[model samples]
Target chain A: MKQNLFSPITESMYYILLSLSEPLHGYGIIKKVEEMSQGRLKLAPGTLYGALTNLENNKLIISVGVDPENIRRKLYKITDSGVDLIQIEIKRLEELLRNGKKVYYD
Target chain B: MISQHKLFFAWNEDKEMDYLQKMARKGYIFHHTNFFNYYFEEKEPESINYAADFKGFDKMPEEEYLQLFEDAGWTMVCRYGAWYYFKNMDMDALLYNDYHSVQNKYKKLLLFLLIVGLPLYYQLFIFLPRMSNEALTGFLFGFRLFVYFIVILHFSATLKIFKLYLKFSKNIHE
Candidate 1:
């Protein structure tokens, strides 16, 4: 396993990556994130765009080009690297919960 | 359409947004801005939310960048350089959801200001000394004064933006 340097991503970044498990356009990802977070995390357009650019630059996400239906909107999807990072993050989060539960119960 | 002359400082963009909102309430929908004047088209008196964001199109194309905002319910009003103006009928609509993103925006603006302003100051320094004796008279004197005024304006704006950047940096976690 390669070292997961991108493990500790922000809540927004994590949700964004998770939303792109299936390919999605910018606005689609925003809506999907809201659905996933149950309205708790509203990803603003500017914030989402910034994260998208950063993720693309880091090679965690790749732009799949313009949407077929909408030429204006660009689509993106998680790369293998993105999946690896997210899995690592999930494990780290589980460990955090486990540690907290242990201290609370003991 | 009517135009109102207004002066806005870099640090007080919120105030500019507020002014636009106020204008909209008075049946003057903000159309665009040309230099220091804000142009407006008359419309039914209604409240509108105005937002200003500083973002360059260097990494992303302008069309795609704008389409994202449009999809998020913000209508583009106009753009002055890298500062894009947007409006939404929903008063509660927010273009930025968190402090971290807002902080990053400020950081980008500060970086841009420094990049542009530093070179200008350097050029001014180099040219001023060589022209000092000659520039003190005639058309050169007026030209020197103009340059000084522009530099002073730039310096004040840079200072304001720096303070705003620091504030955002400190509040990033919030």
Candidate 2:
């Protein structure tokens, strides 16, 4: 996989992928994203749908099945490629934080 | 039984209505009429004879619908030439008209200021410094007052543009 291809993912996209480690339908993903961000970010339906479409198109995520309780619903899960991308993003963010701390404090 | 499916489009006006009709014939139903159009589908009600239902005819193509209207001796005018024109006329037209007016109003206001205001301000700024000693003294003393008028005009123009955006957004939400 191209390492640079993972760099195009935004912070929100990273967190959204993280939230979908387990299967999640639309509202569940929204709730998880909010919880992960501690309510700092709220994803509107339009923005969430747009991100979902892009992620699915990139093969970073896949629709698993409909929620059993709600037949109208859909559930999605992260692909193996998405998990690898997430690991890369975490390492990149750690390096950024380390550099930022050194420059700001020193 | 109801079946829900995802809808996708790339903003093409030509193929939009045919796509909507195809979706509708396959039992899809539009849920919302505003900014984001949402669609779903369900089976016909058992008590209702599907052949006698006028509501199902709502899903028919515009040309066919217009022909039905014409057969009934009503005249129809085609505007926008898309799915939106047939379904939600009052709301869609009001939103479009408001957006158009706001856009036109801002264009005219900006043109007026660019063509007239900037040159007029520049002339006054330059000429006020070159007047007779007495007039020059007076103009220098009143420079703040002149600046104040310019500031007010700038503020008014900014407010008008802001108001237009607010109205445009409000119409979309409604």
lDDT of each: 0.86, 0.52
> Model 1, residue B136: displacement in angstroms?
0.9
Task: Give the least accurate 10-residue stretch of model 2 chain B, judged by summed lDDT.
Answer: B48-57
| Per-prediction interface RMSD in Å | 1.8, 15.5
What digit string (tens of lDDT, one per residue) describes model 2 on residues B1-174? 233343433222225544544555565543333233444456432221011001111222344334333322223322321222333222111111124333433444445445556655664567555653665356565774676587576656656655654565465321
Runs with alpha carbons beyond 4 Å of true place in candidate 2:
B1-174
Residue B167 accuracy (lDDT) in model 1: 78
Candidate 1 stretches with Cα past 4 Å from truth are: A1-7, A102-106, B172-174
Which lDDT tens digits does candidate 2 get at residues A1-106?
3475657456667778999999987667768887988986555332354456568878899989877876445678999999988888888888888999999987
For model 1, residues A49-79, the per-residue Cα lDDT tens digits are 7888889989999988889988889899999
- Output the TM-score of candidate 1: 0.91
TM-scores for all predictions: 0.91, 0.40
lDDT of 1 by residue, B123-161 (tens): 589877787775588888887788788899889888887
- lDDT, candidate 1, equals 0.86
